[model samples]
Target: MTSKTTTRGEPAGPSMTYSAIQQPAAMSDAGNVLMNWREWKTLFDCYIIAAGKEKASSREKCALFLHVIGKAGREIFEELDLDDKAKTDYDELVLRFTMHCDPARNVNFERHLFFEIYQGAENLILTQMIRGIKGSYMRERLLAISKLELDDAVSWCRAEEGP
Candidate 1:
C-alpha cells in the first residue's frame, strides 16, 4: 500500500519515504534495535524499489544502500548467524569477490561474481535472493553479483520468511 501525506493542506499522492525495519511503527520508543542481515536485506530491497522508480533517483538511493552496507560491516555479517560450514563458504565467497574487484577487470565481471555467489551458496537467504530475479538479464546479473561456481539446474524456489 502507498503511504499518503498531507502536503499543501491536501493529501499528497504518496510519500517517497519508508521507515527502517528496526524503527517499525509497531515498536515502542526504546533502545536501539538490532537487525539481522536478512532484515537489512529486506530494507535493501525496499530501498532499491524506492530508488528504482523514475519518480525518484535510483542511483542516489542505491548509493545510500552501499553506504549503509559498508557502515554495518562485520555487524551485518555477524547477524547472518550462519553455521560454521556456511560461514566458511561465505568467507570464501567474499574472498573471491575481493580478488575479482580488480580495476583491470570489467565491472561486468564483478557482477558475474555476485551472480555466482547468489546461486552457489547454500544459505537459504542468499538462494532466495537469487530466486527473486525474473528476466534473463536480471538472473544473469544476480549470478554475476558474486560468481560462485555452483551446479546449474538447481531448482528455483520461492524463499519463505518465517514468522
Candidate 2:
C-alpha cells in the first residue's frame, strides 16, 4: 500500500493532530481598564477568525466570549441589564461590554474643552513670536498694546514693514 505524506513530513493518517487557537488574556488592568477591554476584544476577534468560528451561532459566540473574558469580565456581564435573548446574542454582549468599559461622552463639553486648549496654545505661540522678534522696538510695541490679538499683532508688524 502507498503512503501519503503530510506537508510537515508526517504521514497522513487518521490520528493527525490539530491545534486550537490560544485564548486571549482577560481584561484586568484597573488603571487602563478601557484600553485593556478594547485590546482583549480585538485579540478575541482574531482568535475567532483563526479558529474558523466566524460563522458560529450567536449563542456559541456568546459562550466563547464569556469563557475568554474570565471571572472579572463574567461578573461585569452578570451586572449588565440584558434580557434573555440579548444575553445569548454575541453582538449584544459585545456592545454591553464596550459600553461598560467606555462611558458616554458629552460632545458639547468636549468641544468647549478643545477650544479652551486651542486658544491657550494660540496665545502661547503668539507670546513666543513676540519674544523672538529681532527688533526691540517691534517687540516692545507689540507687548505694550493692551488686549493685543494675533491678527492685531500681524497687522501692526505689516504696517511697520510698509514699502
Candidate 3:
C-alpha cells in the first residue's frame, strides 16, 4: 500500500507493515509514515500531539506510534524490549527509536555551526554554513568580528580541516 490507506480507498489492515494510520475523518492531516525516528517525530508532533480537538495524552501518543508502525518497525521496537517504564514514556520511546534507527548520530552538528575565517582584510563575520542542521546554532560568538578565545570551537573546525 502507498500509505496506511489502500488503493481501494480503505484503511489497510495491521498486517501491512507500512499501513497508513487512522486519522480523524474530518482532519486532513496525513498520518505517520513510520520510515524512521526523525520523520516519525516530526509528523507525530503535527498529527498526534495537538492535531485533534484537544491535547492527546502521553498514553495516546505511544499508542499512535505503535498503531502506525508496520511489521519491521514493530519488530525493531519489540527487539528493544523496553520495560514498562521505558515503553510507557514517550521521550524514552523516541530515544530508543533514535538509538536503533538513526545512523548518523555520531556526526556532531556543532562542527557545522560556523566556518572560522583564518584571515580577513574586509569585514569579518564568523560564518556558519551548516547544511541539513536540525536546530538553532546561533550565538554572540558566531556573530562577533573580534578575536575570541573559543578553543573548543576552533578545535571542532580544525578537526574537519585535517593535515
Candidate 4:
C-alpha cells in the first residue's frame, strides 16, 4: 500500500530530518542543515522587519515563520509560546543579523546564508528564493542577496576590500 504525502510534497512521516533535507546530500558539508534551516527562516523574518509592510509586519512574519517551523517539524514555536525570552532572542537575533542591511541606511550580512542554502537546492528552488525576497523594500539588497555566490560571499561582504 502507498502512504499519503503532504500537498507540498513532503512525506507523511514526522517530517524529514535535517540530514534528509539536503538536496544533494553532498551539500551536507555546510554543517547542521537544521541550523541552516533555522537561520534562513530567521533571515527571512529580518527581511520583513526591513520591509516595514503594514499588512505583512514583523508580527505577521513571526506567524509565518511559526507555520514554516511547524511544517519543518521543529518545535520551536511551541517553546516560544511559554518562553518570552526565546521569542525575544529570536527577534533580537534577526534584528542584529540584519541591522546593517537596513533599507533606511546600509547593507550588511549580504544575505549569504540564503544563497548558500539555495546553491544546495535545485535551480528552480533558487529562483523561488529570489522571487520570495522581491517583496522586500530594499530591492537592491534583495537583488544582491539573490545573486550572491556561496563561495564568494565572504569576500563580497568585506568593506575594506578594494574594487
- What tens-digit string does per-residue lDDT give for candidate 1 at 53-160? 323444443334435555444444455454655444533433332333222657888877886776544554456656765657656745765544323323332222
Estimate candidate 2's RMSD in Å.
8.8
For model 4, the stretches where C-alpha displacement exceeds 4 angstroms are 1-35, 42-55, 80-163
**Model 1: residues with Cα > 4 Å off, grouped in runs:** 1-7, 14-35, 51-62, 74-163
Winning model by TM-score? 2
RMSD in order of candidates: 21.5, 8.8, 15.4, 20.5
TM-score of 3: 0.40
lDDT of each: 0.46, 0.86, 0.55, 0.45
Predicted candidate 3 versus true structure: per-residue lDDT over 1-163, tens digit per residue: 2667778766777554433544532212244333445555566566663446136666667777676655556677788989988887777887887777755543455333322234342222223322222334434433343544345445645665588
Q: Per-residue error at 100 for model 3, in Å?
A: 1.1
Q: Per-residue CA lDDT of candidate 4, range 131-156, in tens?
A: 65433543345356756653343343
Q: Which stretches of candidate 2 lie over 4 Å from their true place?
A: 1-18, 121-163
Given candidate 4, what's the lDDT at residue 76? 32
Index of the highest-lDDT prediction: 2
- Cα deviation at 85, candidate 2, in Å, is 1.2
Candidates ranked by TM-score: 2, 3, 4, 1
